[model samples]
Target: METPLTANIKPGRRPPDIKAYRKAGGYRALREAVLKMRPEEVTQTVKDANLKGRGGAGFDAGLKWSFVPMGEEASGPKYVAINADEMEPGTFKDRLLMEGDPHQLIEGAALAAYAIQADVAYIFLRREYHLSARLLRRAIAEAYDSGCLGQGILGSEYSLDMHLHISAGRYMSGEETGMLNAIEGRRANPRAKPPYPQVSGLWGNPTVVNNVETVCNLPHIVNNGADWFRNLSLTAEGGTKIYGASGRVRRPGTWELPMGTPLRELVEEHAGGMQQGYRLRGIIPGGASTEFLTPAHLDVKMDFVSVEAAGSRLGTGTIIVLDDHSCPVGMTLNLEQFFLRESCGWCTPCWGGLQYAVELLTGIEAGAGRMEDLDTLDSLAAMLAPGHTFCALAPGAAEPLGSALRYFREDFERHIRQQRCPWSS
Candidate 1:
């Protein structure tokens, strides 16, 4: 299952050697960019491609790189952190790239270091992803031994040093700034904006944090040029997306498809449709933290702008579809339980609101919900939105609950009205 850049990889198997990857033109981009292309040109290429962070925010990647200072101070010993803490609920897509093609990530990190004039790179692996950490460490040692990481790599003055840092295995560590905090060995809490990570990050150095997939796009962008990469978009936002599938499906796995591919195509054509007896009911579109999309939105193009226009986002591009006969309240309850358990306790909203959410959603699912309970849930989610919490955890928790209430209000009402689940036996 290969695309332009990853075309040589075998399906369901880990990628091949660093030498083979290089033979197939892997580190060529890093070498070329660091030695020939200007750092500004690298940022311009990314801008032309409209590459968004594959993390949840969908922030522009090129713009993020542009935020780095080009002064003499920024030219040496700067940093690039790979947010490999892939712990978002329903977001296991990064695990695939990490476990399968470790060198792709490493070379991409090297290329990013060149683009941003950074020498230090770190991959923040989650505690649970021990296997990914092991594999990446192996690949990093291999890169360094092969002279791709040490000083004067491939006979160029430009050098990139990669390091592996394991997370404490918390969900908050996935947020960009919180990840920065975690990487610094500080308590993982969201930092205040107006001084985003680019301005000041990772031990007070100019840092650029990118998702595993976002950085992995670099070699392709450099090798094929930005226009070729941008042309991969099925919508206005260019590049491919990796979609993760699970539950009530004939086959559930990650596949790289053109960005903005339709939901119906992903479900029906790619996922092999529903299981024997199930029918498509809705989709989470990104991760469980994202809002749900009803069957009416099956035609929505899977991109930042289109998913937003469809009243959701293309966060992480992992689509968790719900089939008919599944209880929506139960689905939300399971996710809320996760949010409650994974709260970093850095704020009241995520810490306390998640507890309340579990209780409220549990009462609804248990047929004990009061009429006012729905409003209570909505109000809580409202209070937890942007600027309320230190980071996006609380707000991300609210996305699904808010959308569930909006799109499935009647179902919620019926559960309360009948004091029983319609889908239950």
Candidate 2:
């Protein structure tokens, strides 16, 4: 219930200006990191706090920061890139944060840049977020004018220049490496790993791409010690998470809850339960990319490990509920269509495979599917799994369809047997 991240956000309102934000202790962490703490010290503090990335991938943020090589042998002109391309379906948490508290992000970016010893930072914001972009621009300018950013921040020798780059608006750009390519004015395709962004990124230098929410925790971790930060969570991880819900929920909104809050609590308590005349059926536990969780698994904790254990993921903490009246096949088909359209067309599996999935799911949704189609769907999903693709795009695209086939097989069969949507009647 201690909503650290959403504390400054007011419903249906723009963020307070720079002076007000400073009054609320906004830039203190940035100043502390730059003036009082060493780069390694800042990173170590975050590491000790067990801070994890909130950008779908639950990677350890501190570990990511520590991966950037240091000393003479390390690469020069390292960069810190903020992943603000919030395009994931059912995920509006980052957009809300950006729109309501742009200064929080700016302060977070400055602290992150200082932690990584990067003089330059870029916030790769989505083009659709015009208001968020304007707010960020104003916040950055205010930071510079107030001496919290640019040339000797807070009278310290350290300096960080922040740049806001509006993306061309591709879903693939949400991928860390793909975001880097987009920032470089190239096609928004995911790059091969092994020499990850931490080693060579953004103009071919050591870079760290952090989510908007992930870095926002930096100031808190610094101001209150690692122990305080760690205790914020009820689970093994540190800090509260912004959990969002949509679809048939009566009160569909985002809430800053403990990291391991129950999926049932999120839906029933936070979302005000399903709408009248709608019974809970299934849930896309994370974003559209995550596997579906049936009512049997509603008690599952909404954390990375627990959700994964339930054959889904806690991606971005955004839940899209499925009502009993809704046809699962149609739902999956809609998601597959999104994947198909968003594919960068770089690889066969993702580009071609997603198209194939779209075709198969569309046919099934339209009552033209056969019994063999289920097997074909399973095969296609396997082909898109982790090692079979260039990036997580294909793997993620496969999750919903694959799981829908498993949990809602009877629904698919009903559609096929009846030669029409079962839920239509």
Candidate 3:
């Protein structure tokens, strides 16, 4: 398959050194942007390409860059922060990119920094990604030595300083403002928008936070025209996505497939179908936070709009498969438990509501559930939906729990009536 992002990645070898990356045209986009394209021109190209954030939210990448104040009003220091804190359950695509293609990220970050005119850029990585963090640091040093980064980059007037900050591995820091707080040595709690990141972030100056995959698309978007990038997708979006799979699949890993590929193809083909003796029950189509899609939804195209049309969000492009032998109540309980533990306690709903969800899900999984628990879960999901929480944490948790209750209500009822998991036999 023609994989854009992983094209240069060779298996069983360390990530390509700076020399190899340069030979393969790694920093070409950054140099072009610094020497040829204006900041606005770069931003406009990305906008035209319709590049969406790969960090769950499908916001247009170029449109986001355009939000940063430019020229004299953008006086003081600006920043570009890479949200490399790949903390979402079942999402390891960013870690794969960072570990297997660090320079790609550096080059992409450079292009984004140039677009936003950010002198300083930060990679807020997850603490668990020690190998990736080390690889990224080495790549950044190599970039500096080659003059692809640091003062007077590519011998152009543009200069950029890049830094790496390994986080304490909190899921909250994956949120943009919370990421800003972590980078600034503050607690990893999300900040209210409106002095949004582009206007006031990273020490009260303009900043732009992009996901690792989102930034990785910049180099390609700059090298190829926007039209070409858009054509790369199987749908309306631009470029390929690093879709991943875990749990019960014969071959569980990530691949750079064209966007809008059918969910069935991803599981039955790319992931090598379910393991022997296991039948597909449902799938969290985009990580643990998205709604569960039953086998009936396997035909749905895996893209933001299509997934939404099918009653789910294509978040992170990572799917966690649920096999027939696995109890949906238990699986949902595990996910809700994670959300409960990771909550920053910023708001009443997420802090309190997630805890309530965990308790209810635990009871249901333990075969002590009441029929009323179904209604309670439904009402709780509504309460935690987007607007009710300070951040997406609770709402995200709501998706799986809510959907499990809807699509797998019989599973919950079976546990309650039988006083044991249906799969236990």
Candidate 1 C-alpha error for residue 300, in Å: 0.5
Question: Which lDDT tens digits does candidate 3 get at residues 183-228?
Answer: 9888889899888889999899999999999999989989988998
Q: What TM-score, computed on C-alpha atoms, does each candidate reach? A: 0.96, 0.98, 0.98
Assess each prediction's global lDDT (C-alpha) against the native.
0.84, 0.89, 0.90
Q: Across residues 1-425, which tens digit of lDDT does each residue of candidate 1 receive? A: 23753565576676767888888888888878877888899889989988888987889999989988886755445899998988777787888787778888998888887778887998888888887888899899999998888788777877777889988877878888888888888888778876877778887778999989998898889888878888887777878888778778898877888988898888888889999989887899888788999889989998999999999888888889888889888888898888788778878888888899899898888889988999999998797677788777778888888898888888899999998778878
lDDT (C-alpha) at residue 185 in model 2: 95
* CA shift of 361, model 1, Å: 1.3
Q: Which digits, one per residue and each the tens of the lDDT, describe model 2 over residues 1-425?
A: 57878888998877988898989988888888777889899999999999889998899999999889876577779899999999999899898889889898988888888888887999999999999899999988998899988899999998888999989888999898899899899999989997889999988899999999998888888989899888988888898898999999999988898889999899999899999999998999779789899999989998888899888999999999999888888899889899999989988989888888888777877778888988999999999888987788889998998898899989989888887787776
What is candidate 1's TM-score against the reference?
A: 0.96
Per-model tally of clashing residue pairs: 0, 0, 0
> Among all windows of ten consecutive residues in candidate 1, which has the lowest summed lDDT?
1-10
Ranking under lDDT, best-scoring first?
A: 3, 2, 1
Best by lDDT: 3
Could you give me the TM-score of model 3 versus the true structure?
Answer: 0.98
